[model samples]
Target: MAHTPFKSVGMVGLGKMGGAMAKALVSQGTKVFAFDPNLKETSVEGVTLVSTLETLASEAGIIVIAVKPNLVEPVLAEFQKPAIFVSIAAGISYSQLVAKTPQGSTCVRVMPNLPLVANRGAMGYFCEDQAVAHVERLFYGLGDSFRVTKESLMDAVTGLSGSGPAYVLTFLQAMAEGGLQEGLSYEESLGLAMETIEGTLVYFRQLRRKDQNLHPMEVRNWVTSPGGTTIHGLDALERGGFSTAVRDAIRRATERSKELGKG
Candidate 1:
C-alpha cells in the first residue's frame, strides 16, 4: 500500500541527531513534537515539547526512538499503545524494536549519519514491509535513504555510510596538511583540498549518470604520467600503509557494530 507523506512526527530525545532531524522535519512544514526529561522547556523552535513519553507516543502516529540504545527498552516500556517506531539508536535491531513495542506497531531500524542535520545525509534503513514508507515520509526532508533487504546488513551500512563522513573529514584534513608541507598557507590549502574533492565528486556523478562505473584506477591512470608527481604521491601513500589503514578502519567498525547489535 502506498502511503502519503505524514503531516506530523515525534521524537523521544532531543540530542544532537534527534534535534537535527527535528529541525529538518520542521523545515519541511511537518508538525514536530519532542519529549526529553532533561529539557525543562522547549529548546528547539517550531517543535512542541511534551512532558511525558506516553503523551508523545499516543499523539504521534509515527514516533522516532531517538534515545540511546540503553534507553530504548525503558522508553518502550512506557509506551503501551501501538505506533510506528523509527529507531535511530545505533545497534538497536529490528527484532529488538518489534519485541519491545506493542503488537500491531511498525518498526524500522535506520542508520543515519551526522550530516542529516544539514539535510544532505546518506541514510540506510531496514524493515520487513511497507512500514519503511513511514520512514521515507519522515525522512523526506532530511536526506537520501538506502533500504537494506536484511536487518543484519544494517551493520555493514553502519560501518560504511554511517561512519564514512568522519573518515572523509580526516582524509580532507590530511590532504590539507600535505599541501602545508609544500609551503601553501593553511587557509589556501584547505580551500583547494575542498574544491578538488568536490570537483572529483562531480565528475564521478557525471559518469554515474551515463551508467559508467566509477573505476577510480582508470581516473588515477588518466592523471598519472611516467615518473610523475602523482605516482610519487601514490607511492608515498602506499608506503605509509594508508590503504591498509582505511580497510582496517572499516573492518574494525563493522565488528564493533556486530557486537553492539548483539546487546
Candidate 2:
C-alpha cells in the first residue's frame, strides 16, 4: 500500500567511505552494486562489484557519487542513464553536480563523515524537493539525517559536522597528553582520555532529559570550582584563547569546503 525507496543502490567508488557505505547497506539486507576503476575485479560479500560506472547506474535506481571532490564532474559525465545522482563528495555542491550531469537530472548533495562507516555518523543533505524525501530514506540507516532548506547552509554544515571529528580527536589527544603530564602511563592516559570524553557525552545525554535550560557554558561554570585544579586548566585554556581558536578553525574549513565546490 505504501511506496518504498530504492531496492538496489549503486556506488561509484570503492574507496574507504564508499566501500564502507556499501557494506552497511548490504548488512541492512539491501542490494548494493559498486564500481571502482582501479580494481581489476573484486567483491565485497553481499555486494555486487562492477568495473564501469555505466554498469553501476544500470543496476540501481539510486546512484551515489562517492569519489574524490575533483573526480565528481568527470565521473558524472560518464553516466548515460538517468538514475538519481547523490553526491557525497565533500565540496561538490548540488548545483555543480546537476550542471555536470544529463539534462533533467535529479541530484542531491550529501555530506557524511567517517563515523558513517560505523553507521553512527551524522549526515547533512540538501536537494531539490523532488529528491529530498528519497534521499532521506536512503540515508535513514546511515545515521542522524538532517535536511538543509537552503543550499548555502551546506557550507556551515561542512564547517561544523564535516570537520567536527578532527576537532574531537584533537581534543582527545590534548586530554591524553594532560593525563600523561599528570603521571599516568601512556596507555592509561589514552584510556582515561577516551573514557572521559565518553562520559562527557553520556552526561550531556542525561542532561537533555531535563529541561535543557542550562547551556554548555553554564555547565562549564558549574564544574570549574573557584581556585580548583579544573579552574587552573580552564584558566590556561582561556588565556590561550582555545575557544577562539576552534571558531577560527571552523571558519577556515567552511571557506575551504566552499572553494572545493567551485573547483
Candidate 3:
C-alpha cells in the first residue's frame, strides 16, 4: 500500500539516536520541527527548533518520541495531537503509548539499536496496518527495518538486535585480546579484528544477495582444511560451548525484555 508522504516531522529528543534520525530525515528532504529543552540549538539543516511540544505538534504531521522509556509517557502527555506517533523508547508497548495520546491517534512502537547513530541500525516495529508503510518509510533512512506481526516478538527483537551490539563488541574485544597474546600490538589487533568481522559480514551479505542457501558452517568448512589453524580455533570454540553460550545470552536478554515490558 502506498503511504502518504509526510510533509513535516516532529522530534521530541535530540540525543545521539534522535539527532542522527533528525539529520537523516532532513537529508531525505522532509521538513522537521523539533523540540528538545536540553538543547539551545540543533545545528542540523532543515530542522526547525520549536520552543514547545505544542508548537511542534501544530507544525508537523508525525511526531517521533525519542526520549528514554521512562520519559515517554510524560512526553506523550504533553502533545496529545492526533498525529502518527513513532516511538523508539525501549520496552514501551503500543498500548501504553495509545493510552497517553488522544483518540484516533496512531502509535507505532519500534525497537532500534545503537547502530542507528551511523544510519546502519536494525529496527523492528509493530503498528496497525494503516501505519506500516508510513513507519517503514520513516525508519528506512536509518537502515533495514521489518514489521513485527505479533507485538510479543518485539521482545525477541530487543534481545537480538537491540542488545546484540554489546555482545558483538565483547566478541571483538576477545578476538583482539587473542591477537595480542600472539605478539600483535593492541591497536593492530583491534584493527584486524574489526576488519575481519566487517569483511566477513560483507561477504555473507553478498552471498545472500546471490540467493545462495549455504549455511555459515558450510562457508567455514570451505576454509578449514584438515589440521589447519582454523580447525584448532574451531575445536577450542566447541569445547568452550561458544554457540550455546551465545544462544543463552540472547535467551536471557529476551526474558529480561519481557520482564521490563510487564512493568
Candidate 4:
C-alpha cells in the first residue's frame, strides 16, 4: 500500500465538487467527515456526514474547504482548529486563505473542474512549500494533480482548465447540431460527436509527450487538406469567430478570478 499523509479528512462543504471529491477520497480508503449547511451531498456511502462543523473538525486533522468563493470566509471562521487546509474555492487567493485560517497554518488554493466527478479531471494548486506533498496526496487518486510555481498563475489555471470542460461541451453541442442539420437524428449525431471528441483526445494525448512531437496546428493541418471538407469546416468556424469567442471566454474567466482574489 502507498503512504498517505492523512487517512481522515474533514470536508467543509459537500456541493458538486465537494461531494465528488468525498466519494473519490473514500474510494481511495480515506475516511471523510463531511459537513454541509444544507445537509446535501451527504448521501455518499462511505462519507460520515456530520451535523456541525465543530463535529467535523474534532475528528479530522486535515480539512478541505470546498465551499464557494463568497462562502469561504464564514466557513473558514468556523474551523477553529489548526489543520492543513485544501481550499477549492474559485477566485480565492492564497493570502486570503492563510488570512482566514489560524496563524502559521498551511493552505493549498486549488482550482478543480467539474470533470472530477468522473475522476478524470485537472487539479491545479498553489501551496505553502511544506504542504506540497501533503496537498498532492489529498488529490492523488482523484485526478491529474499538479502544483504551480507561483500563486498568480493559479488564475490562469482557473481560467483555462477550470472552465475548459464547459467550452468542450459547447463545441460538442454545436457538432451535434451540425449533424442534425445534415439530416442525422440528434441522438445519433451527438453520440458520434462524443466518440469523435473522445477519440481525438486519446490520439492527441498519445503523441503530446513524444520527444519530437509537432505543434497542435501541425496535427490539425495534417487532418485538413487544400479545399477539402475538413478545411471548409475549419473556414466556417473561423468566419464564425469560433477562436475569438473561445479566447474571450478564457480571458473573461481569468479577469473574474483576479477580481475575486482582490477581496
User: Which candidate gets the maximum lDDT versus the true structure?
Assistant: 3
- lDDT (Cα) of model 2: 0.84
Q: How accurate locally is residue 8 in candidate 1, as Cα lDDT from 0 to 100?
A: 81
CA deviation > 4 Å runs, candidate 2: 1-5, 41-43
Model 2 has a clash total of: 0
Q: Please give the lDDT score at residue 237 for candidate 2.
A: 94
TM-score of each: 0.94, 0.93, 0.94, 0.95
Q: List candidate 4 segments past 4 Å from native.
A: 1-5
Ranking 3 against 4 by TM-score, winner:
4
Ranking by lDDT: 3, 4, 1, 2
Clashes per candidate, residues 3 or more apart or on different chains: 0, 0, 0, 0
- How do the residues 12-54 of candidate 4 rate in per-residue lDDT, one tens digit apiece? 8888999999888988889999988788555788999888988
- Writing each residue's lDDT as its tens digit, candidate 2 over 78-153 gives 9776778999888887778888888777999988888888888888889878887888778767788889999888
lDDT of each: 0.86, 0.84, 0.89, 0.88
Predicted candidate 3, C-alpha RMSD? 2.0
State in Å the error of residue 11, model 2.
0.2
Model 3, range 1-263, lDDT digits (tens) per residue?
65444678999998877888888888777888899999888877778899998899899878999998889988998876598999987788889999998788989999999898889999999999999888888986688998989999999999999999999999999999999999999999999999999999999888888777868887888899999999999999989999999999999999988887777
Ranking, TM-score, top scorer first: 4, 1, 3, 2
Question: What ranges in model 1 sit over 4 Å off?
Answer: 1-4
